[model samples]
Target: MGLNLRAAILHNVTDNDQGQLQDTIVDAISSGEEKMLPGLGVLFEIIWQNSSEADKKEMLETLEQGLKR
Candidate 1:
């Protein structure tokens, strides 16, 4: 099979604590590297899958607001 970026990102960070995860996210965003986007998308996908409908709505609202800025 071909390399799975999402699976690789998940495996690499599976053991990360909350602080480590936060740092990783902050660093990824601050770096502004296009290559890091897939990893962030994987993280967001995991979050979306686990989130409740209300939580998803709130996230979508927040995303919309951010986009408008």
Candidate 2:
């Protein structure tokens, strides 16, 4: 089977603590590298999959507000 980018990225960070996860996200954003986007998208997908309706709503609202700025 071909290498799965999403699975690879998720597995790479699966054991991370909250602080480590935050650092990974911050580093990815601060570096402003397009290559980092897939990893971030994977992380977001995980979050979206596990989130409750209210949590998803809040996230959407936050994203919408950020985009409007």
Candidate 3:
């Protein structure tokens, strides 16, 4: 189920705008909805796996801001 969802997200995200898609996913995770949290570990792992130091920093910052909201 996770792999399937991830694949679908990847496809859908890449099909339109890459940057906004990335932000949307990150925002979803940061929101920490009950349903959103189930696969969050995987998403976090994937983000850290693919992100550079700067990107990771930005992601963390974004997460912090989201938490405040």
Candidate 4:
């Protein structure tokens, strides 16, 4: 059977509270493991999908500014 990684990642975190989700994200980023990126991308995809147009524009601007550094 093919594993649906995005679905699996979402399922694992579906019941998490805000603090738990924050901790999970912090831990993954702090670990600096390349393996964690796909999971983070999945989470970002969800955030992007749910965000308003203004919110997305803000995010993009912030991302662009950060990339210039």
Residues 1-69, candidate 2: write the lDDT tens digits. Answer: 799998899899999999999999999999999999999999999999999999999999999999999
Clashes of 3: 0
Which candidate leads the pack in TM-score? Answer: 4
RMSD of 3: 5.2
Q: For candidate 4, write residues 1-69 as lDDT tens digits.
A: 999999999998999999999998999999999999989999999999999999999999999999999
- Cα displacement (angstroms), candidate 4, residue 66, comes to 0.7
lDDT of 3 by residue, 4-55 (tens): 8766555655554667756777887688787765355555776699999999
Clashing pairs in 3: none
The parts of candidate 4 lying over 4 Å away from their true place are none
Better of 2 and 3 by TM-score: 2
The clash count for each model shown is: 0, 0, 0, 0
TM, every model: 0.95, 0.94, 0.45, 0.96
lDDT of each: 0.96, 0.97, 0.71, 0.96
lDDT of 1 by residue, 1-69 (tens): 799887799999999999999999999999999999999999999999999999999999999999999
- State the weakest 10-residue window (summed lDDT) of model 4: 34-43
Candidate 1's displacement at residue 20, Å, is 0.5
- Candidate 2: segments with Cα more than 4 A from true spot: none
